[model samples]
Target: MHHEAFVTATFKNLKPNDVEFRMSRSSPGRYALHEFMKNVYDLKVTDGNGNALDVSRPDPYSWKVNHHDGTIKVSYILFGNMGDGTYSQIDETHAHLNMPATFMYMPNLQNQGIEVTFNVRDDLKWKVATQLKHVDGNTYYAKDLQYFMDSPTEISNYSVRSFDVDGQTINFVLHHNGTEAELDAYFEKVKKIVLQEQKVYGELPSYDYGTYTFLACYVLNASGDGMEHRNSTIITSTTSLANGGMDGNIGTVAHEFFHCWNVERIRPQSLEPFKFDQVNMSGELWFAEGFTSYFDDLSLCRAGLISQEAYIKGLIGTFNYVWNSPGRQFFNPIEMSYQAPFVDAARSVDPVNRVNTFVSYYSYGSMLGLALDLSLRENGLNLDDFMKMMWTRFGKHEQPYTVTDLHNTLNAYAGKDFGDYFFNHYIYKNEMPDMKRLLNNVGVSLTQDQNNVSFGATIVHGIISQNTIMGSSAYKAGLDNGDKIIKIGDTVINDSVDVNSIWNTYQPNDQVPIVFERFGKTQETTVVLQASNVYNLSLFETNNLALDKKKQKMRDAWLQTKK
Candidate 1:
């Protein structure tokens, strides 16, 4: 599968100086610098008279024209063969395009309008799905470069479904290997999620084009990603609906759809006017991305797509991961949000100490959202009300908000002193929230494994140590990262032997002989197995007769859909 894109732009008015045209270095939803200009080649520039214009190759990314008439015509052939939410791909099957990776823009004329025309093969029966307004047969119009770059187009012979909500159209464009029955069943769940999220904010923000398109590709050759736009979202995955069921793909849809209200409109001020050349970092992703993740699964439970027990298990898993991570001792939620440029889709060959020093803002922020929601519920206010207030103040107006704006809004809802204290401790300081206490307040029990014997560190593949919690048995015994465990208690450690089985043979405070390899040398040490203090939280049965009446009432209200 191979293809080429013939793109042309006409410059009407220009001064007698060098005009620069270049591809984007970074995209909106992606935090890393992707150097998209590397895939473009076969560039040619000419004046209106069809004479060759003098073009200069100043850098690897840009082309400069010095001697051009008032009208300049630039044409280029883009070679794209990979697909995701942030990159462009073209093949015999379809053409998946992310605009920043496909189009070239002048830095000076970024404020001007853009018109793009796609010349599709007549025999292929291809149709376009995007947020850009249609002008005619194959041409689309964008008011400015930002809007053009934010839109992604999918051209294929795919399955499409549409449903009306609040007098607006919600289109689901699917390109997958699946049956029509499976597709219909999957979309039913999607419709429920959309409606449930809308109930949280009390309403959906007005769409830019009176419609929202979910451009989804669940193909065998595609990578997984979900990126949000103004009126649409790009969702791609290697999992098929027929084989993996709706569970594999619906989470991404739930997350990206919620972003339409969170990050797309109630945006971080730093990311309001997205830059295509450099990484855009913001401190509010804990709310933007994190809070959305928290609600995505909750929305599933509320919509009856998932059971309440499944929801509680999911919450337990999230709480365990975030609370036990050693990175929490070093970075707060806001501090972790600043690490996106290095972690979010950014690649590196050399390994670093990310395990010991980094916790994903997604998980951390989700935990923060959960704790805050439960805490606020005890105070007679809920996160749903807080989100509605935010939507009313910022999202309704398409206003870009800052950290201060969030603090002010939260202060108004949850007292001035409490808001300041919450922000300082949870967002600014590297302190873990009291999840045990907070959960108990809502009639849930948070318990720890007190009698089980185990080394405290997380073992990767039963070989390498990843993160050893401070003062735990693993850290006290001098186990560190990159150390390979060769044997435990004279039993040779292998892939077949379960590590936990060996630990379970002994009780807490028992001495166990350990052998490990580090830095090309084998060493012997004595590990005293201790009871793990890390809270492995699980939701107690809500039907228990011993539960307090008031606390059960609080839990019931917390789980129900907000009016």
Candidate 2:
């Protein structure tokens, strides 16, 4: 990968001479402030006649151009190596362009239309795939800067498989070194996901220009990310279709596809105008992102691309994470959502206590979605009806919604008392729902693992890694992160053998002497063990528990195809 791009922008008919052109610090679908200007250098500004124009930097991100004519052209070298939803990557394989990280704009000219012509590398044989309206062969038009920033462009020697659905074109552009058959197989599943998500909302959003595009780069150089936009989505992964990605990458496809109706159009009022100068935070990400996470796998299940058992098993990871975390004592779903700026793919070098303090809104909200789905099913209704109601109230006309609006909509769909109780206990506070009873209602079982014991922390090569769980026996023994467990209960730690097997030799509530090293100092303590809180899920039939046919019918309706 070359990892660099030559960018140019021309602003004509300027009303002011001292115009400010700057790089955005944030991008669509991201909440962190990126120092995009750090990757920008070799900048040169000129007039219409190709004369040099004087420019001054008032801040690190913005450049002020004074004593200029009505027109000024800005060109620079943009270095991008990270290929994901939030950042751009230019390489010999492809140019994965995320606009805020790639382009510079005139802040004052927010309403001005944009015409971009990508100069494709002829030797690379690159072509353009973007949601922007095509003007000519390589040129495209954006009605405004918002649309332009939202439209991510993928230019590479890529293969495309397109289909027509509901009078709209859906394009899947793949840049992978895979066979044509692999692309066809993957695209087939992609098509099924599209239709199934449409069934959730009862219809597809009216995509601009009658088109929606999925710009996918499944190559070795790209990062694994899936970001949603207005009429398009960018899904990048390092795994190719043949290398476990055929099944692994479909969940991202389903998730981002659901966003076209949920977060993309069924919008959050706080995130309506995404500011690029600083971090943008919203309390409603539990709904915008969490609910989408909940539906990602469910949509695939409804599409018949995955089995019900597979879907049920898939919930185990996220469900356990949310249900077992102690972070809920500090924040509700909304408060945890506001922490996106620090946690959403953004982290600091210094060590922090997110292990004890944070729970991902994605997992938390997915479990909540699961709870709501089953709770509604108990009342002879379903989440689809609530979502369809939300779609009509907030999505169809593109009206953004607040927390009260969501509560009111739920009230209108389910009931006032039901909505208030759910909001008060689950959204405002941190109490979990009757997940055990709810799952049992649909013939699913939730039980803690009998053989599992709490080791407090994950271990790697005789060293204690990650934050030890609070109130765990290991914590009571004063073991912490970075402690090297030289011996556990008189068993010498060995690099070759599995340490977990040695730990499993001892049962829960047993106490033994432990030796560890921290900061190069050896220490000794007697540690008491505790049972792990981790749980398991299985169908009643799988567990040999008697299940009535009515519960089977309920399970079928929950996971079966809606269309």
Candidate 3:
């Protein structure tokens, strides 16, 4: 055994029998910094003389460092499990192993690189897969230690398939299992969409580009996440074959992959030189995530995977979300993006006020992206040219931009003073943005139909005041803080409700009569079910216009078609 800060171990004993090792923890957060949690254990089984033998780290539940020892055997647990809260679950028995702790960095030191290798028991049934490169046999190599640490839970279960894209191999590591045929079909669809995105972006310049998909069972209950790196991106979701269709899945892949150009390469000021120890904020998160999120869905639409109506419906969903959020008033996208680390903590209670007051850079940022795109389009400069200019000016430099730098860079690209408007409307004010005027030039119109009045209400698990979003359709419909939805149409809701079964039964612009009660008074209201968060618009629901326009603009830009 070698005693070191990283906790490396060498096994001297050798045995032919099977052995299992358990670590006190499975993440770096629980251990000392400067040490990767996955590297905390190593085993090499030898004869009585301690010669050479094979070693392996098998299974997701625990890292089993294996080797052939003599009559005796020796193994140590590499990392301990952080427990079951933050991770997702495939079944009741198996949960997605999240390694948030692994993102911990050593104080005041830059990590040039780190290596984590894993080998499993040959006969083990547990499937082994990751975003890392697969070496021969059971071994795998995580290329960038900083990135691996940034997203330790970035890996997924072994229920996905592997395919090739543009001479580079690709793998879809999923949290949920689908049949081999099903997975193969999905991978093919994803490959085609990604290839199309690469063509639009000119070329896939990075030496490596990786993709990961997480299947969330309850379509809306799960959220989507994406972060870019030099050669890969960590995308987390509950998206599956069942909920998101070909367009949704492939579009998500393209969006994150495109970040290799937009966000990953020509990055914002705060995100470029990422401070591992603190919250990294940039007023430009809207460009980073919003633009990416907008493109993710739009790329597919441009590829003809979805119709114009479907695309519009999706945008409407996102707009409704953004328009209805009270949090937008509390914190602007810039502050929210900067305070992501603390705001994401469990203590964040108010929908608006976080443990740290922060908004999702993706959600609010995307809204700004929509506004920016429309502005560009109106001025006779399309997003494609803007993207090319940004790439040429900022992306080629391969460096981060500060707030002033972001404004100056955009000004240089657009040849105008564009920062003030974005700052005034998105960063400071809470007035409803006039999206109709923006989309007019692009031939899209926004309007309200009181006859098809949506009242823009949404449902919740309970009638708890805190659970009800302040500006949602439910709140706008005069539903009291403690009112409960006992029934939707003819269906009685119990044990949590099925929003889909109730909503999907109607058509767009269809009216649905809903009943809820408060203070012993049962009231019935006929709500015109305008386009809601439905599969008719795709499985995912959003509330950002920039995200919507970004999607549409990305589609148009990728296809080189005029709106």
Which candidate wins on lDDT? 2
Indicate the residue-level lDDT of 218 in model 2: 93
Q: Candidate 2's error at 102, in angstroms? A: 0.9
Superposed on all Cα atoms, model 3 deviates from the true structure by an RMSD in Å of: 10.6
How high is each candidate's TM-score? 0.95, 0.98, 0.62
Off by over 4 Å in 3: 1-113, 125-176, 208-229, 234-248, 272-277, 342-359, 418-433, 451-480, 483-563
- lDDT, candidate 1, at 472: 73
Query: Which regions of candidate 1 are displaced past 4 Å?
Result: 3-6, 456-462, 465-472, 542-545
RMSD of candidate 1 to the truth, in angstroms, is 2.1
Candidate 2 vs 3: which has more lDDT: 2
Mark the 10 consecutive residues where model 3 has the least summed lDDT: 26-35
For residue 96, model 3's alpha carbon misses the true position, in angstroms, by: 6.7
- Given candidate 3, what's the lDDT at residue 491? 79
**Model 3 compared with the native: what TM-score?**
0.62
Question: Model 3, 1-563: lDDT tens per residue?
Answer: 12111222232232445544333222211111222234444443343455554545564323332444443233333343222223322322222333333222222123434344443324434454444456665444554444554333322234655565555655566554445666667767666666666655555554443443322221223445444445544445556566664335565566667777777677775564453333444556656766777766666666566666576667776775565566677776666565544434334444542312334666666666677777776666656566666677777667665556656656776764665565566665544456766765455556653332333444567353443445445544465556777777787867567765566566665656668887888888655455443212222123333445654554355333233
Tens digits of per-residue lDDT, candidate 1, 410-463, equal 999999987888898888886766777888877677888778875877666656
